[model samples]
Target: MRSRHVSVWIDAPPDVVYAFAADPHELSRWAAGLAEGSLRPSADGWVADSPMGQVTVQFSPPNTFGVLDHVVRLPSGEEVDNPMRVVAAAPGAAQSEVVFTVRQRPGISDEDFDADIAAVTADLQTLRGILEGQ
Candidate 1:
């Protein structure tokens, strides 16, 4: 149940970042570790071919609080909760700080956990690049 928070700073407003990140259609653009180009709408949620296998992603309802929390159901039927958020870097700032929590599953090794963190970091960086038009 151990977890780590991976975050990135984007030169965009929080609302903009949240809007983009919360959209399932835009997941493949940055969240390659989870969706790549295989994400599509499903009756239950969005399904994607992830590194682990096929996964069903269910996102939280849209809101103004910048919460982008989601649940990913693995092919094995295990649901992984992913907590994410976009917030203003400073009070009334135009910049945003995107954070993703990476949790270590019961049987994961240290190396694997670190790799997961690295993957999340890379995804966040890609999101930043896209939003900042780099």
Candidate 2:
């Protein structure tokens, strides 16, 4: 799969950024096109009441390594893997970086890939703003 990676550095601790971004509900705030409405725990994982119907987001097991990966289940049962990571600038550092990996398949054109890159860049900017503004 072809993929693009975008990242933003925020003036906050990695733990804080990881805690907020790891939650599916919180993603709606920064990732505008991700989903909508409230998120609640469901049998499969965390479900969000979105305009596209109920979307499920299942995250990786909890860890202190800042690995905030997750999978999104569409209403049609298609799953999209969103690989994300929050890295501390250094040991005991207050600065951190959040990276998002956007993937595309064989049929994705250059224009679409560019658009996806821009969207991810915007989302990362929003994340930086939110974390830094706090």
Candidates in order, TM-scores: namely 0.96, 0.86
Across 85-134, the per-residue lDDT of candidate 1 in tens digits comes to 99898878999999999999988899999999999999999999999999
User: Where does candidate 1 stray beyond 4 Å?
Assistant: none
Number of backbone collisions per candidate:
0, 0
> Candidate 2, which segments miss by more than 4 Å at Cα?
49-53
Could you tell me which residue pairs clash in candidate 1? none
The numbered model that scores best in TM-score is 1
| Backbone clashes counted, model 2 | 0
On residues 60-130, what C-alpha lDDT tens digit does candidate 2 reach at each position? 99889999888989898889898989999999999998988988856778897788788879888988889
